[model samples]
Target: MSSNPESSSRVDPSIVPLMRSLALELVIYGPIVTIYFFLVLHRTNNWLTNIFNASSTEYAIVAVLLIGGQGVMLEMFTSWLLRRIGLRH
Candidate 1:
């Protein structure tokens, strides 16, 4: 019922960035999943025992460090992938 057609047909600019982030997340999580299977799942008792042996503070610190390391690795991987794909110089 409105004469302004462009207003009704306006596109969202944030969707592209959101999608790119999702794709990057998928790529980033691949290594974490692989590591989980190879290290944690394969040696469930050993890993669980190690966790149980550590103090709460020590466990929290290690968990944070591992997550931070994963993020750093993800960034490196994303950069490498982008360069290989010729998207980044």
Candidate 2:
């Protein structure tokens, strides 16, 4: 058999909803997380320490990594949920 729809790993490329979610998450959490890490935990920055906030050349690269990993987790979760509902091969 060719196979059922849910047997594949292919994700639709449109991804508009996921892109929107990614942007909103970056806007909401990126600065806050970076600031906390740099100023609070690392204690290497001051209020005016925009330098440690995040280099422009690397705009929240770590944050993007975390968010991207979270996206993969979410996809796995959805796949598991769908399988539980008999929607998968």
Candidate 3:
């Protein structure tokens, strides 16, 4: 169960900032999701809510989109951050 730091080429120092940014994204996502649900509920006015609730697939779709959004946001943010910091490869 011993590990060697030099054996791992997958991680780079530049990735540290990106990892930090992703952590920040997770912190932000919670509030964003909460607000998004409230807005959806407001716009749907119970009809769409009931429709989504009646079908697990619909709810699952929402969950997928939410997670996808997080992933894309992390990737794009990291790429943009790298470019901004002149760390792009």
Candidate 4:
């Protein structure tokens, strides 16, 4: 049998304020995150070009690194921003 809805990841209706705060944070950070990633990638564009010509194995490795690296950096940024603004998650 399936677990109760409260245990699910879906947003709970009782925490509208929390949801609003998160939505507000995303609105503020979306552009910043996108630009930061773009600038970081732009600075190492020669590395990017090399990757495009890489073998499949190398491409897989680079893909994992890029995704994981960006995810960690963005998560850290979001955590710092939220904490700085006194939002607790």
Candidate 5:
């Protein structure tokens, strides 16, 4: 409804940094997470299979714990990485 077309097309300056940070995080996390899962799956395939075969309930609990622990560890690692790279304080 506004008369000015330029104003509608303009991006907020404050959002640029946030977008950059998000892009950087995605770039950093993508390969690390992929390699992490690759290694985990490769190394733990047999062990996890055994657990699943032994008891579904136990497997479910262990799977949840592993996922939660992975999330915590990855977050910590990513935060530390960002600090080291001077992207975050």
Candidate 6:
């Protein structure tokens, strides 16, 4: 309700770095994740299908492990990349 227009247009200074970090992460992660999935699917499709056909429970367990491993590896790789690029410490 104030007369000052500047206050309405202002962004929090503290949020700028966070926004930049998120943008950078998205930009970097998008293609890397896409390529990762492409390669993994390409290489593992037949093996995974065979496992699934042999045992549903084994397939479920392997799927969970693969997902968990992907998450961990992606995080590690992203962090390392960011550090190497001097964007993150």
Q: What TM-score do all the candidates reach, one by one? A: 0.46, 0.33, 0.38, 0.62, 0.67, 0.67
Off by over 4 Å in 6: 1-13
| lDDT, residue 25, model 6 | 79
1-89: candidate 1 lDDT, tens digit per residue: 55888786976666666676657666766886788668855776676568768777777887788679878976887667665644323
Better of 3 and 6 by TM-score: 6
Per-residue C-alpha lDDT of model 4 across residues 1-89, encoded as one tens digit per residue: 77887767775455766787798799889898678768887777788678778777787888899889878988888888888878666
What's the ranking of the predictions by lDDT, best on top? 5, 6, 4, 1, 3, 2
Expressed as tens digits, the lDDT of each residue in 16-88 for candidate 2 is: 7556655555565567567756765577334225643647545466557657976797667555644554433
Residue lDDT tens for model 3, 1-89: 98987778765557777676666656665686678668864675666577577998987887688679877976786566556655435
lDDT of each: 0.69, 0.58, 0.68, 0.80, 0.82, 0.82
Output the worst ten-in-a-row residue range by lDDT, candidate 6.
80-89
> In model 2, what lDDT does residue 49 have?
54
**CA error at residue 1 for candidate 2, angstroms:** 11
Cα displacement (Å) at residue 60, model 4 = 2.0
Error of 3 at 51 (Å): 7.5
Please write out the lDDT profile of model 6 over residues 1-89, one tens digit for every residue: 55878787975567666677778878987998889778877889999999999999999999999999878987888888777666642
Better of 2 and 6 by TM-score: 6
lDDT of 5 at 6: 72
